[model samples]
Target: MYDALVVGAGPAGLMYSRVLAAKGFKVAVVEKNEQLAVKPCGEGISARVLKTAEIEKSDYNRFISHVIKGAVIVAPNGKEVIVKEEGEMGYVIDKKNFLRVMGEYSASTGAEIYMKEPVKELTFQKDHWLVKTRTMELEAKLLVGADGYLSFVSRTLGLEKPGERKVIPAIQYVMPNVDVHDPDMTYFFLGNDVAPKGYVWIFPKDGRLANVGIGVQGAAPKAYLDKFIKMHPEIFKKVDILEFRGAAVTIGGMLSEIVTDHAILIGEAAGQVIPLTGGGIHTSIAGGKIAAEVTAKALEEGNLSKQRLSEYKDKYNEYWGKRIKDSLKGLHAIEKLSDDELNQLAEILSPEDVVNLANGENVASVAVKLLKHPLFSIKLARALLS
Candidate 1:
């Protein structure tokens, strides 16, 4: 029996496996996909995550774009506000290469990896958990579900049902020769005309190559995405489509319980994405690290009950749970803004306010800026007063 069996060899699973293996745990990571890092995602990681994760500069190579700036928010009326920040702003990563590097790192630490072996079910036996794959049954002392959305591990572990709200769906594509100014800056388009109850993004990868995507809540995301793209002929005219993809992002926040008697859910399986921005790469990696730390401690103490596993919840709450709750509040505020309201609000905000919001600074500052607007002032005042 292995010390821990990690399902899904994505960033979260690999990171946890690496950390655990380095600490002398017998870990194994199983992946359904034949290759790693092939998920359909926006492929963007902020500088804050890079620094916090201790990702070395030498490990970047072709996996990173060093343009250190911020993003541009464009309203429906063509009004644009560029939010700038100091230090390493963000990176547009080649996610494939990055995942390969992470996999190699985990392997170097003696974590066994199995590709093309999808887990079908999981059950608890005497003093161990049994993971059932197509051709084999693996037993482990602990199970970590690092699978993405639609995670079977989470399903079998009885944490699959989303609470009040499910995640939004996103459609993305890689466009070549796109004529976008300030390649160092990412762009977001707000308004129902572009994406109904959602937003569109243009993240530059390199010279004239960028990732263009849009996300929308509710069903029929593709319909809204199609209409949004068609409405923006000016931006799409000079672009050549290279790749097209779509995926669902969990943003409703974590379930009431992520850890049980012998299983734990991490990453998207636990709904760790930021509700406002729909970004989860950093949070997922952090979740993996935290899960590893908690599981390791539990193993050392010879305790693996739900009570002992509550350490994962406590650590996550101490670290990122408050941030997730704050982002959810912000999401609700943004959802209340109409196109005209957003455009007007953008005019009222200074560059510093935008920077503060993006950098996860003071929430009151952002609320105050919103309150300055005549239309939203009353709502903001009520929110502040309450």
Candidate 2:
């Protein structure tokens, strides 16, 4: 029997396994996928994740494809504003290599990894959890669901019922495209026809290659992406499609329940995602760290009950709870805005404040500047005030 069993060997699962094994716990991770990090994402990750994890440059360099400096916001009316990073903002990394390194590092630390194994069922007895796989069965004192948005653990446990949370359909093209103006910059496109309530993003993995994708609500994401490509002839020209992928993102913010008797949830499975920007990498990594902290202490104290494990839930609230609630207030409030209003809001954002918005540092600095516009006075007053 293992002390901990992590389902879905994604970044969150590997991160937890690594930390748990480091703390001398017997940990095992099982992943459904044969290959790692092939999940569809924009790959524009904030350096905040590295900072939160205290990863050094040399350590992070193993998988980085390119370093990002800033971003561009394209308005519905096609107006554009650029936001440059105050410091090293983030990177567009080779995600496959990053996942491989994380998995290997976790295994090297004595954590057992089993790939190509899908979790068939998770049964909680009086004391331990029985994780049944297609090939074998494993038992663990603690069970962690780091699965994707559609989590099997959450379902089996009856955590969030069907329709309790919302997810957006997303699709992307990993291709050799010539016209990303700055390899150091990412781009965001906002408009109804563009992506409806969601947004489209372009993140350069290298000078000539990029992940151009769109996330949309109430429509086909592929249709939106196709239209976006047709709109940007200059960018999509000579685009040699290397890969095509699609997935769903949980944007309902953090779930109300993340823990139960002898079980805990983290990463996307717990809905630990930012509603507005779809930026979950940093939060997912942070959630894993939080899970490890609580998991280790519970194991040490020999208290695997949910009453004791509730410390993980409480601490995560102290850390990310307010941020998620506050950000959701802003993200959901914006949904009432018309496409023209969104364009106006984008127009109101100056370069300096745009940078602040991107970093999530003192957004009030931009809000104060936004008050100067009469349109902002009418439309975004409620969102900014709250």
* Candidate 2 Cα outliers beyond 4 Å, as residue runs: 54-56, 355-379, 384-386
Off by over 4 Å in 1: 65-68, 162-165, 355-361, 371-374, 377-386
* Model 1, C-alpha of 123: deviation from truth (Å): 1.3
How far residue 145's Cα lies from its native spot in candidate 2, in Å, is 0.5
TM-score of each: 0.93, 0.93
Tell me, by lDDT, which candidate is best.
2
- Residue 31 CA error for candidate 1 (Å)? 0.9
Question: Could you give candidate 1's per-residue lDDT for residues 211-327 as a string of tens digits?
Answer: 888888654766766676677676667777789888788777776678888889888777777777888888888888888988998998889998999999889878577667666
lDDT of 1 at 34: 89
